[model samples]
Target: MTARWKDLCLDADDPAALGAFWAAVIGLEVDPDASPSTPGPVSLVGPTDGHRVWVNPTTTPRRVKHRLHLDVDAGSVAEVEALGARVVLPAEESGFGWTVMADPEGGEFCVFVRDEPPAYRLHGVVVDCRDPFAQAAWWGRVLGVEPVHHADEGYATLEGAGPDDRLTLDFVPVPEAKVTPNRVHWDLVGDRDELVLLGATHRWDTPGWTVLADPEGNEFCVFAA
Candidate 1:
């Protein structure tokens, strides 16, 4: 059986602060039921179960550019900056429709301005890889979704994967190889053995979940069904 998208997880130095930043920017709320007595992830909830986001605590500092990042739709770039996001590449200078930005902790994300904010601000998840088509295809197989390839743009997208079909998984070509562990990753519910046969290599495991790297070396966690 193929894996199903579970939720998004982010490594942060301060889970509480980062969780608050994302909750405010994305119109989500900090999960009130999240355990406060233990050093655990800070959970953020949206209108749907598929819209959950976890800000997990980590001690390792980010050393390289993020291979995976989030894309958001906002009223304006200034709106996001007001929430502690810093602009890295302005849309006008990049000749792109979106502006590149960094979170308060320096993780990169893209912002697309809209006249009116949509019901959901989290637009998509993007991965930088050497071969966009292959990377997208591999994830499509694992996640049981079809990838729509954009040959002219050198990118591929997997739609219908998250809340209200508003979230997309995008793969775009990049020159650089992944050298450090990704600060952002997604989780899935599936069988570990089946995934291993699908070309995923086991990375490590904990009592709760096992970490596996995809064909392109992006790390993701798998929880048994």
Candidate 2:
């Protein structure tokens, strides 16, 4: 199975607006397979090869820390700024040089100078819900990863299933209700049509892709061959 940083989930109130903003910032194609009636509901937009960010319609308002987040290392601060990222704090010279900034959606990420070959890397993903245990369990069942450690009584993490891939799923607790659509989502690689029997919902009138969500409403897709 060939895998890299394929997707990131972004909770948003207005899926369309947020998706458009990210498309401009990251130069990604929007609604690559979405339709008019259902509105895709799940937007998979980002760099085609390296990374793809999904915008999910979120009902709960963001008031506390993000359960999931990302840390990106760019070649230069100028390049990211030109892409519409605002510098929350100016770049400071440290023993190791790195600059931090926030995306258009108010998500914080970093830009560091490194010589490693940059293909596709998923820094990390945070999963938040009212019921942490259940949500974690559901994801584990779908992805084949289990809880490796607990961050607190309200949070836990699922470690990567491989030696080469550095992936961690952070599950956090939330008190608010989900109100809007999900702008970002994931794409599973197993049997596409079978997932439909697993509560996966088809979006719009598309045939190549099918949108599915967790019990908590976190969305993902199954790409057909």
Give the clash count for each candidate: 0, 19
Residue range with the least summed lDDT across 10 consecutive positions in model 1: 32-41
Q: Using Cα atoms with residue i matched to residue i, what is each candidate's TM-score against the true structure?
A: 0.96, 0.55
- Give the Å error, residue 102, model 1: 0.8
Candidate 1 vs. true structure, TM-score: 0.96
Tens digit of lDDT per residue, candidate 2, span 101-165? 67766666555544662544344455667887877776666667776546556776667632225
Model 2 regions lying over 4 Å from their true place: 1-69, 73-83, 87-101, 105-121, 151-153, 161-164, 192-205
Q: What local lDDT score does residue 142 receive in model 1, on the 0 to 100 scale?
A: 85
lDDT of 1 by residue, 1-225 (tens): 289888899999988888889998788989979835467789999887778999999989999989999999999999899999999999999999999999999999999999998867998999999999998888899877899989899999999866658789999999999998899999988999999999999999999899999998999999998
